[model samples]
Target: MQLCAPVGCPYFRGMASVVVEFSAQEPERLARWWADVLGWHLDTRSGTVVQPTGPGVPLRFVVSARAKARKNGVHLDLRSESHDDQNTIVERLFNAGARFADIDQSSDVPWVVMADVEGNELCVLEPRKVYADTGPVAAVVIDTSDPRSDARTMATATGMELAGERSEFASLRPPSGEGPFLEFLESESGPEGMLRVLVE
Candidate 1:
């Protein structure tokens, strides 16, 4: 997702986690899908149906008529405790309306790529030590035209520490150096829109 243009919002620019709102033909349906998958409650009281997940931004889905053109540049990477857990979760996701995503990855790929009810891409990763402490979500990755600049902007805005930076990629973690990370990688014309943001 693109960096938010925070101006006259109610909360301070850096004080709040960036809310990830998706444009969906059926906001309610999409919201329900995520809520079911994440086991979180959906809040539709304030217009958008939201499912807040920990310190990260609340996942919100807004009603839109326009359909998405391609796979998103930003997607969720869900971690598993073991191979069995991964298979279980993948089965649950498909049962709940998720479908296999043909991302050109062969059967040897370690992660399970799937699309949400509205075709938003997400990966169920096999358990690894790196994500042992990051909780269920491993990280939020964004493909950017300029990786370093976008990473710097996000680090400054969120007070996240820069873990690494390069022309092709950059990574950031919270000030305390815990939880999920926000990563940026160089690419041509990344998908544009704000869907979900990793906030702490």
Candidate 2:
């Protein structure tokens, strides 16, 4: 289960690199949507890519014949600077084809859940001190049956530090400690269309 570092990983150890890829029916459109959302530049020269704006991993979208059929196992949680900014981001997303997602989250939760144009769920979270330095994206969360084990595997493979762990979630951050955290969340649902860390 070992993975080498990728070119853009902030803490790359020069072994290999990592990237998060999306399989989309319309790769270009999906890539554009994400690029706009993350304020990243879209690079279509090689493929539909959302180039990393910081130390965060780059996102690449490729064509897929099948459409999304269920909730995604992987999703992004966007960080907001303030309450007003959170509201503004949600509003902008809605105008760009995002819709509210009902994932059984509590009504009192501080985050707003919404699905992207392609039915991928994402969270726009209220400001939190812990994520203040995590750039635009707060975390790349994966739903797993065993959060601790998965988190450990990912942390080891990617040279990330095990940042936190609780009953239902385990989190990791790169050695540099500034990019988005990789969080494994406890869930009963099996993995569906999910994030992949490709090491080359």
Q: For candidate 2, write residues 38-121 as lDDT tens digits.
A: 888888877677876775667878788888888888888999999999999999999999999998899999999999888888
Worst-scoring 10-residue span by lDDT in model 2? 1-10
User: Which residue pairs clash within candidate 2?
Assistant: 5-16, 5-17, 6-16, 6-17, 6-18, 7-17
Q: Give per-residue CA lDDT, model 1, range 1-200, as digits (tens).
A: 34554422122234535555678888888888887787766887776555434433356677776787776778778878999999999999999999999867799989999988888888999888766755566777787898889888877777767888887999876664446667787878574643545333
Q: What TM-score against the true fold does each predicted structure earn? A: 0.83, 0.90
Per-candidate local distance difference test: 0.71, 0.79
State in Å the error of residue 99, model 1: 0.5
TM-score of 2: 0.90
Clashes of each: 1, 6
Instruction: Give the per-residue Cα lDDT of candidate 1 at 10.
Output: 20
lDDT of 2: 0.79
